[model samples]
Target: MLPLLVVSALAAVQSLAYEQTLGFNSAPIVETRSLDEIYHAALAEGGVVTFWLGGDEKGDEDAIKKEFEGKFPGMTLNLTTDLSKYHNGRFDEQLAAGHVYVDSIAFQTVHDFPRWEEQGALLHYAPVGFDKIYPPMRDVRAAYYGILTVGWAGKWNTDKLPGIAAPIEWEDWLRPEFKDKLVLTYPNDDDAVLYAFDLIMQQYGKSWFERLLKQNPRWVRGTRTPDTVMQASNSSWAASFTSDGLFPTSNINVSHPVQGSFVTWFQLAAIPKDAPHPEGAKLLHNFMLTKEWQATRGSWPVRSDVEPPTGYPAIFEMPGTNITYFREWMSDRAKLERLRTWFEDKLGSAQGLSPLIDGI
Candidate 1:
């Protein structure tokens, strides 16, 4: 619906034209084509509909691919991780050639859509159910929508940071007592954490960061790092980054307004302009935004018609939840890159990383 009609072209393959058929009533039927028919046309016409997915959810990718192939026979899905590391070059090389090899791309970098569109690397392809998309999501040009909205929050030992003055605000992280006792998630590898760090720097400035850096943070490469550190009570304070998780049910406390710290949206998806099988891509996109598929994907549903995933209360946009709006951070890529550099220069070491309790 965003008309993410990104206008980019591909070289490895040729485009296939197929008759489209909507399962709609009151509409004159010209030619309605199922996803299978379109896919077959792509294969028959000498093009492979490649679906590229990025993230840790390999299982979800498998399921999505499975469902897609089930619906559209002969289609192929190619999944990969570490997208952020090479996303810029990966697409740039393909796009600059004036003949790209890849078609649709899915990543957690919500900002990439606008940037790519600006670069004229995206294609516009309106999916089947554009009107049903939520307003916030509709504003974006990319047709692909992320099934799960992510949030940047914190996890810590309540027993350690006890009292009304919870370590909710970024300022709390700099408390003299809390310093030298914190272990946050990795930032360089995970932009979601980097986005949250950007908020801390934006709100508090260098002095605050300098002080927090003194406390030391473990720069481990894992989303579960915070959970691992907090669950063991290794650090009295820690940074929790999660797109999907339950804090209440778990023993560790994840502060969402118990004090401060804003939760920001982390990622989104978009359909490609030169889709070998645009029909299948659109169908899969529609299916993902639907309640039925979200339940299986294990993330917040974008549709108001769908209930939040069981046991979940709200998303990054909900009221009382102060979100930094990761979209804002996308503006200054250099600054983010520098922030990552600063984190490494200041706190990515044994001496800089907070150690577990001495006895333990």
Candidate 2:
């Protein structure tokens, strides 16, 4: 009898997964209302709507708030910032316990999507105008798409790395002169950084540790940290994985080291499954994706109809390489811990890291 019950429970769980995964997932356009109506409705709304703004996006909140206020009059955004040290860790607990402090999140891909999706944290939702989203942008089951668009490339201070071309054809980070000078963010923390290394090694060579050793570099907690350091002139960062759409100043130029292979990664926005206020969430989601909001933020918008703001570098102008899933490069669940140990012990040394170019 106990065995039969266990089998029955497993079948029930499988049934639910099928319903959600293959469910009616389509993007629906969110309706709008008057400012007064919108504000009152949101204030009296039944559930809370929470969003996460990472360090890079903290600057865009004002535009986000203004745009929401203008578009979906009654929708309440509950605008907030959460830099909780344990972002990925806490998400695990919350999703497992089913505590949805985060109604929606705007974060990187490193483990946000795959990890959360595995836990059934993502709600299968498609907002209005979903058809407009590019294939890579839409997640058939996650109910979120990348709204803030940016391209990836090796950026540097031309004044510092003199004699180097706009984009040096760099296959690894361990050139002798570049050793210890390479400014990099750990990909384990930021998937974009992870993807950058994977792309470099995959296209160039696996034993690329030689490149890292030559350019002895410092480690920053966040990808932006290294980029900011490069901008402030703290160190001469010969090459780094960063968003080309943004620069510390005009002095920073984004270049394709390899003429035709620039890899671009998108930061995503998503709604939670089992949301208390799904309708309100939908309204907010669509409002954020609109051209007006994206243009006002001075960031690249995913929509083709929207032209980039003044002085904005076109993401498409650079040759784009798509980032595919890499379990080995991800270091997976076990490898990540192994990497953390390796980083703190072996790679942490200030000495130039020899590029592990062969037999990797």
Candidate 3:
């Protein structure tokens, strides 16, 4: 064996190297480095990155693969899109098995992230442009940040309801003339829809839902159904449609509620602690924050420097917009369950799988 002091010194060096590899530090550094620096570092470390995106596996594979590959010639981008709920379960399994494969995650399941942070499953690295992000959209601790803003608002088929005006308030749907003509996503089917109902109840009182129920408004299971119904002119109005500013039909007009609209949980992004390619993940995270990347998305970017697409107002400029803090709701599981039970009792069973719950 080598001398004791020499052996001890070597062991200490090895421990320090291990900690550095794991990104362990007294204060996690906020990544302010340039994209080029991160890119070269990523290339030096095998140049492979994986992202778990929320929602269906629509043609994002080709687009993201093309964009990232074009941007970083030598880097390899592995992109997978699945319902956030399914990804969450998959990630939990990965963590339990100590076999993490994903480098970064961008998803709509805002509730589970806080838990992940608490467990130290997340790497705390604020990407470049971190300071430019909207204050409410980023975590104070810099564990995770909101990259996009999606709103739940009222919409209608203008061609079908030429004589009728879009609803400017929650109570506008309760108009006697609109009875049985309004459609909304079932509150129990989605957390965002449930939060919207809670907001309406809080602002208008408990009897607000009771009165709206009296109108015989149809309740569907998915958020997309309301928008689809409105597009097809099957419903006069949809009460809780997500406005992405990319509707397939021009006849369907979406408007934020005059009284206020709910900014459903922001689509959140974070790096897992055991990511295989931290530099690649960091490079991708920084790239996402760029105005160039944000401008391509239908949802509003969380970065203040990025201008929203023409016709849509900037997030801060929107009047009476309530940002829903999903962390609070997730903490109160009992209340969520109770509310779900109550809604089912009143509105009947939800017809289909909630994209939030069933990952459909």
Per residue, candidate 2 scores C-alpha lDDT tens digits across 1-360 of 569756665654453333334444533334445434434555566534666654333443555666665655545567654332245556555554545576777665444565456545676666555556666666755356766765555677666776664545655334455555567765444445545655565566646644565456665555445556676665566456544444345566564554435455556677777666655666676666666666665555666667755664454543444433332345365665554455446455323221111110
- The lDDT for every candidate, in the order shown, is 0.53, 0.55, 0.72
In terms of TM-score, which candidate is strongest?
A: 3
Clashes of each: 14, 31, 0
lDDT: worst 10-residue window of model 1: 12-21
Candidate 3 per-residue lDDT, tens place, 1-360, comes to 899866765654343223232544425558867899999999999999998887633443357778888999999989887667678899876766566899999877787877777667788888888888888888766788987666655676667666676667877777775676677777876666777777668789878888987988777655656655666543455344433343335566666666755545577899988899999999888988888988887767788888876676886676766454654665577898888888889888878654334432
**Clashes, model 3:** 0
Could you tell which candidate, 1 or 3, scores higher by lDDT? 3
Which sections of candidate 3 miss by over 4 Å? 1-26, 43-47, 56-66, 73-76, 233-249, 308-314, 324-327, 353-360
Q: Tens digits of per-residue lDDT for model 1 on 1-360? A: 232233333322113122222312212212245544555655565434455665543343467666766665665655444344355567655654455556567666666777565443455554444444455654344334444555445566556555435456667666666655566656665676676666556666778767766777554544544555666654454444342353443355655534344554534566555555555455555545556665554555555566665665645445434333465666678877887787767656323222122121
